[model samples]
Target: MSDVNATSVRAIATKDFRDAVRSWTFWGLSLLFFLLVGLAAFAIGYFGNADTSTADFLGTVSQVTRLVVPLIALLLGWKSIAGERESGSIKVLLSLPHSRIDVVLGKYLGRATVLSLSLLIGFVIGAVVVAVMLSPPAIADYAGFIAMTILYGIAYLGIAIALSSITKSTTIAGAAMFGVFVLFYVVWNLLNFALQILMNQGYFSGVEVTQTMNGNEMQYERLPDWGLFVQTIDPGVAYANALSVIDAVEAPGFGTAFSAELFPSGVPFYLQNWFSFLILLVWIVVPTAIAIARFDRVDL
Candidate 1:
């Protein structure tokens, strides 16, 4: 394989980005995000009391995006390389002066840019609506929320693009996309539940801690720090925790009494919300790195 050429990467990225922007996929995502945010703002304004703040609005939107962004990314990226290969269009792509590394990097950037732009367009529209509906909008919190959401989307895009490059068939790529979805959305959540059950069954030891609630002392078993760390390793969980750290929103159920009991001294650096930012970064980097390495050696 040839060494990475910045000029080649840039040219490929530009071409891919232009092509993606022209597609309905880009506009559909933009519309989807806009509707999701607009509805969230409307619900907050219509149903919430005057005390409902912009942080609350952002929190709600973040939850929605956590589920929606990965799906958008997967759909957008599932066929990036696999579709090209299946249709034999990859020959034209490689006929250019680009290397495989350039193609992989370019594809990842192009698809990620599509998702990012759609997010921006939607958030801008949503911001305007939110500003009018919610007084004293937490612009800082909203900005932080948007930033973290983009990172989260990029992480999934990276995953999707990597998977796309590994296979020659779009059908297999589509299945891989579904597997990615299930791995994160369903299986990851189940792991935490299963761990708790094991601990309850005495299969895994848990830390016992006591706390006073409304002047009544209560004792409960909390997951060990390692277990808590495992729970936060999910990209979606990391995204929420990162938001709490950046926006100071005190994400619901995070760092609560139960959490404090799990870490009496203090949350370890790895398990802290700030560390989740690192976890998100790792998610964005690792999968793509592996894909790039493997794609370079594969028979195209």
Candidate 2:
């Protein structure tokens, strides 16, 4: 295949975005997203008694970013190529002098951009509203949260786009992709839990435990922080990772523990943050690459 032009990608992206922003499907759902996030920020700000801490904000923000943001991306992406195929537009679009890979990647990127921009705007507004109402988090921390959330959303978009390539029905594509995303969120936890039980029961008997004196008291805990090591394998761990990133310095007053013990063990607090980001990245890239490869072999 010939090189994909920057101009073509941008043109396709712009077209996709315009169509997306104008459609009732996009606006209707996006409006709901804004309202939900707005209400969440409101609840946390007003009724939450400004009892917010960095961890509280981070946790809430992560929930919004990781879950809600991904759902929106899926909504945009699930229908992308599938809807085009169903409407008989894919042939015409594919006939245009562009590689299928470019078309697919450009569309996905465009929709991901829309999701990222919408979420970013909501985050800014929410941050301002919270700041005005209560003591806000540090600017740097909130910024970091936004960056991580955006990356997390991009990963979900990959999943949706890949799923879209699998079917020609928008509804089926949406449902299937949503189901998979839900599975990603839930499965890792089940694995983590099972592994935790087995580990604590000495399934990995080679795993060592050590006794340490924190302050003259002898405490026995598993070495290599096997329990925490288990958590690293879970998606919820990424949510906690994002939370820890935001709450490292100034946590909120929500009675949520910011202690290192509350975090997964075996890694320094900062390393855990990096590790979680990497996990989230893997979560996005692996399936996405598979989808792209699958699409290459299928006749679209």
Q: Write down the RMSD of all candidates, one decimal each.
A: 1.8, 4.4
Clashing residue pairs for model 2: 53-252, 54-251, 54-252
Q: What is the lDDT of residue 59 in candidate 1?
A: 72
Candidate with top TM-score is: 1
lDDT of 2 by residue, 1-300 (tens): 346677777878888888878877555655655566566666667767545765455556565555677677677788888888789898898788766767777787788778777767666766666666556757887777777767767777777888888787888997898687666677766776676677678766423334334655343434244555556644445655655655533333211232444333644543456567777778777866776677666766
Candidate 1, residues 1-300, lDDT tens digits: the string is 568988888888888889878889888889999999899998888888978888788778877888899999899889999999999998888898989999999888888888899998999888878877787467777777788889999999999989999999999999999999999889998999999999999997998888777889899897878888888888888887887787735346433223565567976889877888899899999999988998898887
State the local distance difference test value for candidate 1. 0.85
Please give the distance, in angstroms, between residue 270's alpha carbon in candidate 1 and its true position after superposition. 0.9
Off by over 4 Å in 2: 25-30, 48-55, 135-137, 200-203, 210-230, 233-236, 246-271
Tell me how far the alpha carbon of residue 159 in candidate 2 is from the true structure, in angstroms, after superposition.
Answer: 1.1
